[model samples]
Target: MVGLLVLAAFLTLADRWAVLYAEHRAADALKDRLKLTAAPEVEIDGFPFLPQFVDGRLGSVKVTVPDVSADRITLASVSATARDITLDGDGPTSVHGARVPELNGDVLLSFADLNRELGASQVTFTGEGRDRVLARGTLPVAGHDLRLRADVRIGRAGDQGIATTIGGMRLDVGDLATYRPGARASEGLHLTPKSVTRLARETRKVRALLGVPSVVRRMGVPDATVREALRNDDKLAALTGSRDFVHQAMRVNLLDLTLAHPEVLDRLGLDPALLDALSRLTRPVLADQLSLGFRLPEPERGELWLRDVRVEKGGIRVRLAGQGLAFGD
Candidate 1:
């Protein structure tokens, strides 16, 4: 009886290895099919597999794809669980194909990944300790790039899915001389968007106020609407007052803005950096598809259901459920 037990144990262990080896091969095939950057983690659930191996069936199988970057956005992971998988009975040496009952899983995408997609040159994102994210980056103000940081609060955007809002809008100069009088001696008027007119075309009016340069107002508008800073000459002088070399810097930073067309990039006092800021968000990212949930109907001859998604830290974790799996040669 003891010898028989030893033989059974060995057979079970060997059977498990065989199943794992076969799974590795299948995962390789899956990798090719999905065009994955890396092969996913695969596991067969339960133990003492000799019986299941002989029958060419599996109780359940789990698969995890660590990172799925559909476009600019990267989902942390996508997991699926297959239940009651029926394998090709003819492939005794290798379990090929399966009939699944029902499969369910989750796809997780976190805020950190979003920041990563923002690019290394952009701001770095940090966790706010409570379910929130903090990001700091240079903002374009008055055509100048100013140091700015914003707290992105999570909120739902009606039918648009999850959304974010900017908070704690603050823009500052690194050199005291830029804002402080006679400290290091800067050039031009270092102003923010708020210092200028509230309208887009009015961007030209900002330069007029700084006493920098003039602009040819676009067609079909009131002259007063497109008035140059020279019109605000008195106000421009008042703006300088005693603010030392700052008058020489002539750079303006635009901050906390809702919208600006790329056409206004050539406007002065506007940091060319605004090009990055405007283009970065406007280039048409695949963010919509990333935010949208996904479902794989026949991953393994069964439907793998993707139900819920939760974002955390650098990655996401998902739970899976499955059904109606059928395996054939």
Candidate 2:
């Protein structure tokens, strides 16, 4: 009985040694096969190694790799579980090839890493709902820092691409108004009722309007009436206090107005460069900045594709699947 117990202990140690050696070999092989920057951590499950080794099959294997660069973005980490792995050699040390019947993985794009990599405009992304994310930050435009907020939807673009659709992107132009970028001037700067009312009360703004004689003339106010209002505070207030003027001002297409009368920008203390910048920030261009679309690199040995996308607290997670994966075959 004592002799049997000693033999059992020896077998157990030998079994453990075999598993470790196999794991090391598998890690190195995968690193080379996947072209990974470093060897991934590999673990084979369902121990009592000798039987599985003899049969040349591993029931389950887990692999994790970090900092995988995919297109313009970097995946924080990628983890996968491969199942029904069939080894093609007599033993661990002599193993030359293997086949994975099925595998599922998760590619995590952590917000911290995203902020460091894709946050060129100081914009940062955060998960909004199960399928959406919110981007908020500042964009530099013509020497002024403009605040921006956007709602983005997460979805699969193709079999292996994850994409973002931006909606309701707004840029704040100080206290003047919110700019809604678009393909045409009809969808330009918009002023809320409160902003319109506030503008009517600002003395400097009222003075600036009076300073532009052409604008006064276009408003159908005679030069004498404008001169009189320029001297008397009550006259100027009465002239700007009319309901029709305030209502029309709120509905004015600032972009069209500025394009038609370039002097309007000067009168409003806005640089012409600001308009040039806004012209280039159309809907599509702005959306491109927040686009998270990326395609996974095709592996040399097997089929891999993106399955789904989800917005999680950590970041955007894209589900991946693979089949018939083989190494060194």
| Strongest candidate by lDDT | 2
lDDT, model 1: 0.50
- Tens digits of per-residue lDDT for model 1, 78-131: 777777777764667755566766676666666576667763436566656444
lDDT tens digits, residue span 25-106, model 2: 8888878877899988888888798798788888998889999988778889999999998988767557788898899999
* Segments of candidate 1 deviating more than 4 angstroms: 89-91, 110-113, 127-134, 139-305, 314-329
Model 1 weakest 10-residue run by lDDT? 176-185
Q: Provide the overall lDDT of each model, using Cα atoms, as 2-decimal numbers.
A: 0.50, 0.80
Q: What is the lDDT of residue 312 in candidate 1?
A: 53
Q: Give candidate 1's error at residue 16 in angstroms.
A: 3.0
Q: Show where candidate 2 strays beyond 4 Å.
A: 89-92, 184-186, 191-195, 202-239, 242-247, 257-260
TM agreement with the true structure for every prediction: 0.55, 0.83
